[model samples]
Target: MAFLVDITSHLNHLNAQLQGRDQTVSDLFAHMNAFQRKLVLFKEGFSFSHPNLAHFPACEEMRRDVPECNKTFHKYRADIETLQEQFKNRFQDFYAMQPQIALFTDPLSATVSEQPPELQLELCELQSDPFFQAKGNERGILFWRLLPESRFPLLRDFALSMASMFGSTYICESNFSTMKHIKSKERNRLTDETLFHLMQIGCTNIDIDIQSIVHLQERPQVSH
Candidate 1:
């Protein structure tokens, strides 16, 4: 149970990182890379029971079987590698345009020695600046919000693209969960318009004005 909880928490953390508004493709890759490493280790050693398996005939046979434990392990490793490659290929254009974006994504990187000369000069200034140096617990591109666009033009565009990309369907999933509760059998007769308004109001952070909500009688009539 404890192991399951820990694994769930780690996955939830990864999901949270991916679903951020400021998350970049690079950020997604980095998180996935680290997570994949952990998964590889888990695949290699994790077991249903016991820390290490003693040499048993069944365990030995299972290891040899193509459709059993060995096959599952190989499949997982292959899948991770394939997915990583696919992401790299898909975003190759962005990377080709701005190789320096990778350096800008890392808050801890102190130098841009590998970056092109033009990007190097701008980043070197930011590298030592106290503001960029102060990113402690900040996630995604929120810290980059302070940097001027002129200084990091390539990074600005890259960050904007990342922010625009949808990392997950968590919002949609949450909407479905909300609908499941609201549209129970007893409330099956609720109109689609009413449900839309209910869902919109429930999901938003801003307060809705009572007076702003038009009554059914006051609503604009729609003639077919």
Candidate 2:
């Protein structure tokens, strides 16, 4: 799972680095690159190859778009789309182990009978998946809300509070990444306490900024 997290971050980094323009979508045949090529050759060894398992759908569409792409490399590049689709389905199955979060229906979102459906069905599928019933905890893209179906109200409340406060473990990883980027290994070594302080400061600043923005967005200024 940590490997998946790093792969996601690195893929985003690679995408930004490879495409200098604001509106370009070029998939990194990253493993095919000289540096990572050797590592990517064997999918089972390292995590850098994980991105190859998650190529975008748009990349496949490009095959029909570009009539001239007849080379072997072009065909291999198209594998990205297949890999991405596979990743989504595989990931869903893996996350399905979370315990059920039974909640009363709000009926706010559109019903299946409605003209335009909303995420109500998706939520239904989410809660129904065996993933939640099997495991007590589940993680998704951003937050990991505690499922409310369990009998322990205190446990549910604590989990909800932590999920709301932390949102995702991504923020924690971001702090760790920042710590790494801040100082080179060759430089003077810092004590664990110092690094701890840095992460504490970073989290504090982020919390304040997020709260301020949320508060500002909640209130609209009226013209006098």
Report model 1's TM-score to 2 decimal places.
0.45
TM-score computed on alpha carbons, candidate 2: 0.29
Model 1 per-residue lDDT tens digits across residues 1-224: 33334445666877777773335566666776676666555545434333222323343345556334543433333544554566567656655644444554674473567765655666667667777677644555676677689877865665576566554676577778888888889888889998888788777778877454544446644420
lDDT of each structure?
Answer: 0.59, 0.39
Worst 10 residues of 1 by lDDT: 48-57
Q: How accurate is candidate 2 locally (lDDT)?
A: 0.39
Put down candidate 2 lDDT per residue, 1-224, tens digits, no spaces: 32334445656654454442111111122211422442244232222322233333342344356634323223343443555456556435223322221121121221334311333444555445575545433332112343443433443443343334331245556667777765547533766786676567654644455445545765743210
lDDT accuracy of residue 200 in candidate 2: 71
Worst 10 residues of 2 by lDDT: 21-30
The segments of candidate 1 whose C-alpha lies over 4 angstroms from its true place after superposition are 1-27, 46-104, 108-111, 116-118, 135-137, 169-224
Error of 1 at 42 (Å): 3.4
The TM-score values for the models, in the order shown, are: 0.45, 0.29
